[model samples]
Target: MSEKPISKGKRSVVITGASRGIGRALAHLHAAHGFDVLAVARNFKDFPHHPNITCLPLDLTWSDAIPKIIGCLNATARPFERLINNAGIQVELDLTRDVGDETPALIDREIALNLTLPIHLSHAMVPLMARPGGTIVNVTSLTSRQPKSSAPVYSATKAGLASFTSALRHQLAPLGIRVVEAVPPLVDTDMTLGRGSGKLSAEAMAQAIYDGIAAQRRIIAPGLSRPVLLLNRLLPELVAKILAKS
Candidate 1:
């Protein structure tokens, strides 16, 4: 492991989109693992009330989201040990201008939530991250390695994040922070509902992610991600054809 092992205890973990799916599972998993979890989500009505979990209700797409997050951290008077940029949106829009009924607003929102927000959050959280053992986990997708025609914008954003994660890893290495790019296969979540079959459960994916972080891996590609990525490298066109249909 190139990164230092994270010390166990009540260190804070900030997770975006923690109301459901992978983020929610991660919040609970970390809390169970002895980390103080700060769950950030717009909806908190169904949030799991745990002693180690604190809910922060705010739209991550808002203009002042970063400031509000920073303010919250400052109020806690504690540097977070981990920041998981897990909030993202996927919109199926036809880019063809003539027959397409796509809204520009939706496209902007998707990009903002998926790509732009993570970049800004990573930068803002640097100072607030615990030194020497701080870790940043950026959740990307297999669609990142290959573009998906159905969710073209989502593909683009994840691809952008993947590149950013690599560069950030190098940049933060000297600063004693570890940046991890976590790639999960299609999971059984609201996002993928009715779209894919044989999806991995969010709980399982969360466990894989936690294990990856514990192992201090720079790139945590879980489930089919490892094989898909290897195949993509050897046969880009074939993989692209398969993922485009996914």
Candidate 2:
């Protein structure tokens, strides 16, 4: 599908998972700031309708379609200043439970969306973003610091993405493209549902993300993520115990 024509001289940003929650907030924030936004997600029935925002509804779990998606992006006349890898899914499956016929498929989809899709998108987009001041933002989770007991696969995928972001930052530094890791604590999104207490609102988290990017912060850990990351470093055993009980 062709991207909506953007006005001349507007900076562009690509944000995945832009249909709701933090992603939606980010899309609105950037659009409000006069950035041409390419918002990608599976559903766009409720996506924002703005002159600066172009909604592309596509399921990110289809890994093979990534190249075509990137090609469509590259064909656009607008210059891409930022790529926010925000599309993710969490499957809370107990490893101890009996294996169901659908278990493997669910696990595969989780890994594809959370880890593989970002990697593929970044791999393709980095070359296009070789210009100075370009940035890649990966939205990981606090679960990366301490794996959750109920969501083992989801936690593992986040942890893997965290490692990839770290290595990518150093690799892309010489190219003048910054790789940023946004490790958010439990956000009050549909993904979390009824799980977290005192979770940061999506708008608040989106504002923090914008601020962090503007400041060029390599790691943006908002709310409880700040202290939790510190505790993970300083008191590994205590952090593990706490996570186990959580």
TM-score of each: 0.93, 0.95
State each model's CA lDDT, in order. 0.86, 0.87
On residues 151-223, what C-alpha lDDT tens digit does candidate 2 reach at each position? 8999999999999999999998988899999998889999989886998999999999999999989999899
Model 2 misplaced stretches (Cα beyond 4 Å): 1-3
The lowest-lDDT stretch of 10 consecutive residues in candidate 1 is 1-10
lDDT of 1 by residue, 47-159 (tens): 75777787888899899999988877776746679999999888886787424444777788899999999999999999988888899999999889888777788999999
lDDT of 2 at 89: 88
Off by over 4 Å in 1: 1-9, 97-102
RMSD of each: 5.1, 1.7
